[model samples]
Target: FSEVSWIPNKHYSGIYGLMKLTLTKALPSDLSKVIVLDTDITFATDIAELWGIFRKFTDKQVIGLVENQSDWYLGNLWKNHKPWPALGRGFNTGVILLYLERLRRIGWEQMWRLTAERELMSMLSTSLADQDIFNAFIKQNPVLVHQLPCFWNVQLSDHTRSEQCYTEVSDLKVIHWNSPKKLRVKNKHVEFFRNLYLTFLEYDGNLLRRELFGCPSQASPDSVQLQTALEELDEDDQCYDFRRERLTVHRVHLYFLQYEYTPTEDDTDITLVAQLSMDRLQMLEAICKHWEGPISLALYMSDAEAQQFLRYAQASEVLKNRKNVGYHIVYKEGQFYPVNLVRNVALKNANTPYVFLTDVDFLPMYGLYDYLRKSVVQLDMAHAKKALVVPAFETLRYRLSFPKSKAELLSMLDMGSLYTFRYHVWPKGHAPTNYAKWRTATTPYKVEWEPDFEPYVVVRRDCPEYDQRFVGFGWNKVSHIMELDAQEYDLMVLPNAFMIHMPHAPSFDISKFRSSSSYRNCLNTLKDEFHQDLSRKYGSAALKYLTAQRNM
Candidate 1:
């Protein structure tokens, strides 16, 4: 309604965007919040109620969880197509959510003009369609997103898109018939899709266990049979079960602990354990020799930090045959890249099904991967978070980086070092597992990997994607890295364990060190002032520290 432009099949040339293209800009205005539901959608339930849901989140910025509801027959045409990285089974533009203020602040309108429009007609012929246009926004402002449930936009009658309606037909919130033709309930397609929901969410290898292989249902039951079994199980914190098949051959990774100080002879608990840094080589060698899980070393380093790492690796018996050890360094190169880049890189290179990212210095307190393995067993494959961050990845040294001598190093450790903003996650109710609430099958679960490391997380790689722009070596510019993060990958953070930046003891005050590091001294007086403004603007943003590094 702002302004109008005309095209052939589509008309949005002026203020608005092409109908085929959807939104003309990346974000909404600073003045108000807006929700744009696509014209193709048919709402079978009350999504109008969602506005109330939006009101509850006054401080947090967000976009609506889009349910890709493009028509079924038409969907088959594009099912193979990879559209917005916000990725669902497909792109259905029936419903969309937007935030105007952030959009204007980030120059989204200009970005849209630059990225979305190609000549006048090219806008009419873009590939991302409307959602791709929106994805550009979604990736950068993920925190501003709200992941709506799939039932909100039911694509009815795909392989099983409409499966949940059979059992919970009355519970349907939004039925989005986004198909190309005017879609309606024809055959009992909705009912079949509804019933099949239970099968998809809980599907495991139970059938394969029983069938031609002749394995017993007790030995391994089909998912449907397992569903009957789970009815007997209760949800208890301490209670968990494993697929019997997993009992056959199990591989475990051990996290070693800190070795800096020697505790008093009589004070057994307080004494610093002897150096495992020395044994790491031998221990890892043995683990790699037999166990297959990946073992990662998490250490904070700068261009200046000593390569005791290289020495440790050199000492490793496995390194004598480097192929077996599988050593890799994970970190971003740019000064503005966040500390999480290192973790992201390590996870990326990890090959085994079970990847262990542990501190080279300190190990977990209790000798345990058993309780965690049991926790893993209890996960609803469809509902489980793939990456598991444990209090396991830790060190003995506390805050050593903050030492006064490490001042310059501390400077480098400050915020806004990361080039891109984190991505939005798939809203919970929208996940395939929600079918279980209605006694339906769950869809296979996956987490999009757009790394945002504030509160800790450990995840299994489902769609283990990284913004390739940030990967390898690449020079970055404003919004470009964020643009890539926005276009590809979804990020989720789960509360759990964290990576301990092991210090020999709580000797250094890294934050003070950061304030006083070499980078600070080298910076011009202007940067010093700008640094203050930046800290205020981004609020402990990693980029400020990185920017100071860049300035240095």
Candidate 2:
């Protein structure tokens, strides 16, 4: 396929341009026929009508295509336009009805190859890949194509003469934006078409009806306890009201669309669950590069940010190629960061048995992916209720080469360049990891749960969901770890595994927590309610270790 030369243009010069030709071999043997539509085409009418058109095909017809709407093939669109060979008006490959079984029945592969080779000798280079060869082939053997009506694919290019097919927008079945300028393309009915496109973009899909088929998975008794506590709170309790409002609102998952990475059976055991806002998107490359396994990433953003993130991710050198990362966008709501809410989304969307919950800013120790896999098996975490903690450290410097090994990390720790996360500001944050013992220990060590202890860990997918009641800064992760303890899951530290925090400016919520007394006071109230709810559900044993819970 590479032997044939293509016109030097970014839009239509890749080998993927010819992928449509190889679909007969690419798809399964049992798949008989399929409709292939370009990403630029938007259906104005029901697609069922187009599928029914297949019944109109003759036994000799193996492909269905609409005639190209412009005079490019006739070399009349521009002063010196040189398009490849075609029969009269060439057929467009944008919207195709492929009869795979019939194509394989005939020697379609060998025939197209010969046609392409023969045409290339004269044309020297084809502007469009398979579209050129396809038209050239049909010019010789016209029986293979069943010409579709032009209305089925209303070509909307700058030079498109498709006005002959439709006098009104209602007559068009599909609108194909064949030009790079798309909405900016010069058309007689530009406003109508542009408005139509924008209307679809801003359409409210909630108008569609949906049905729940079965009972939802029941929440834990502790969840009900928390709800009861919130319900019984005074009307003036702002924190409880905030929690209730967030809990009642449904979270939007896969905001635009979802592309779940398919991992090998052996590699699907563990998924890294992390949450980030738009500002942290650039960190995805380093995270993906170090962690080769599957990742469940939750992005917190507004509607505009979601669109911006989609564009950035598409153009990113590292993010564009990663099939192992699953991006779930949680639309930003209200003032709070919704930190735990974002965490819950990532956790719930994860498909693997175990998930390593961490922040997107942290880079895992080089071998942590493989190390955790071995630890999960050796520790029998799949069957046992165990959470393997990956000790976290942070550097004050904004930029530094991350330590690749535990020995290097220990060396940096000794040098005072790296310290346990929040060591000076808040020692209790990760103090439970007992880093003093971790320095010499070579095996997993049991960690007794303490108040406000929130270390990143790899736990089972079925582990308790993050407390939605804890919305913002203070107790977001603290409440989650407290629940895990209440549920009686063992927190064990992996001796070798570590995560280094790439420091950044404080989050909006954290800044709010520090400056606003009301914010801290609200967090304290929410923390009290959360602990009380846990105690009521788990019978006071859960909160026994704390005579007093510290306020952040």
Candidate 3:
């Protein structure tokens, strides 16, 4: 085949052999018939059935094939040849039964010489390469071609075409998916073909599940047992309390440390701070297992809820034996959760030189601690004012079981899905609202625009704390972000580092709170009073510092 000389077309260069039908000329003179099949086809019947078609061809016919089911050829050739059916809309080359002796006797090489002419070659190059040339040759000599039954090459491009030909799956002899959109589960012939394809391989449930849903092939016994238990649990029971049984039944822990960085004796100073409320025992356990450093957890709830958590913690041997974990209770009266106040209390208890402020639900990915440790060591702690920010993603709402590893958790995040900003500028304010633009970056960059503080922030011990006055959900942390900007500090967003936020039901109704009078009053105070106070404290220093940072 390689000895045959052929003209190369840029569009069809990859399949040059198919474009020129090079194999036909390379065959010996004794060979009379040849059947060519495309790779994107499936054979339902015996190969002998396809070979039987060549016997029906007439003495003058050189090729026997089915017409293309689509109007794609007509559209491509319409510029040169007008009207719909003038040149007889082409045939599909996918299933071709050719009489090699008849083609050689007809002087097929003359067609290649005509295609090489400068004027004709330019025209053929612009059109669909091989198919167009074959159609033109057949049009010039109509007696040299014969049309086969549509059933011989069943086109599954359009589902409607199936009704015109084969009505049942067993009737199909050859299935050709020759359309731009290939065979998907949504396609009409998918069910018919999928069942037949699966039958050829002796269907295995475990292999199919792993291929479809990314289930681990070599999952440990503990993972399999936990998955089965979770499926058997009642849907109404939101809180499952069987930590001791899980520990005894499964030899391995729920989560494992994949990697840990060893720090110098003098550089071992960092604390993770989080604020928790009722019905968050599962999240607390995950955080304890995931982090390798010390943690300062502030539990903000009623006296009864605090006691409930304590009982659960004592029952679980893993949490009870951890000496590095410390708990602080901030007993509150009302149903409203004070976001900033509890966070402030947790930050205050952090005794390390650097502290990471985050929520209990956020689970840091593996290697996050090592990345942060390296970042902090390179920074000038005394003179450089900076805060490290990490990207956060929420899991799908319907997913019940937590992933056992960081790679598993990341595979769950839908591609091209970005987290929506929790807080937007309310009632006509001049602030940028599109937070997704930050994700276009691939490396750490400074946040000079209106940045939100909803993500986890790692800062020095002397950095300004959250304001305690702003109560529940709305604009609590955002106000602190504004203050940090006004104090001339750099907010660097790390695009590579990530933390997955576990799915859960909302603690309170967001729409009801947004419409209440108290919420409107809080918005007013934040814009008018807070802005004025910051301006009075540092009038021009903020702008000057911002200019210097941009220059750097």
Off by over 4 Å in 2: 1-155, 162-235, 248-260, 263-268, 545-552
Q: Which tens-of-lDDT digit does each residue in 164-224 have in candidate 2? A: 8767556778888888788898988766777777666544433222334433769789768
C-alpha lDDT of residue 355 in model 2: 94
Taking the tens digit of each residue's C-alpha lDDT, what string does model 1 give over 1-552? 321133222313223334423243433333455667655444444456766666655456545664454433233555474333443443344565555655555565565555444333343543434555555455545665666666666555333344444456565565543433333445356454434443432343233234565435454456566666556554451212211211122111222222122222321111011112222333344333332223454333322221345666556655445342334432212233232344444455444333333434433322223333443444432344343333212223343332221223223334422111111221221232121221221222333322213212233433333322221112111222222223332323222212223334321323322555442332233234434544565564435354534654
Itemize residue pairs with steric clashes in candidate 2. Answer: none
Candidate with better lDDT, 1 vs 3? 3
- lDDT of model 3, residue 495: 58
Can you give the TM-score per candidate against the true fold? Answer: 0.26, 0.66, 0.45
Model 2 TM-score, 2 decimals: 0.66
Cα RMSD (Å) per model?
Answer: 30.3, 8.5, 23.7
Ranking by lDDT: 2, 3, 1
Residue-level lDDT tens digits of model 3 in 1-552:
343334444344344534446545777789998888776677777778878878888889988888776565566534755322214556767788889888888787676456445335345343344555567666667788888777767776642233666565557777776654555624565677666654642433223224555534698887788777767755553212221122222111111111223434755367788877775667877777777687777776554555567678778877776756667766553345666667777788777778777778888766676677666776554457877776556554545354544345445543423233232333111123223544455556776635333446778877788875555556666677677777767877765566767767766625546667755554555445555666577887545434433454
Estimate candidate 1's alpha-carbon lDDT, on a 0 to 1 scale. 0.37
Q: RMSD (Cα, Å) of candidate 1?
A: 30.3
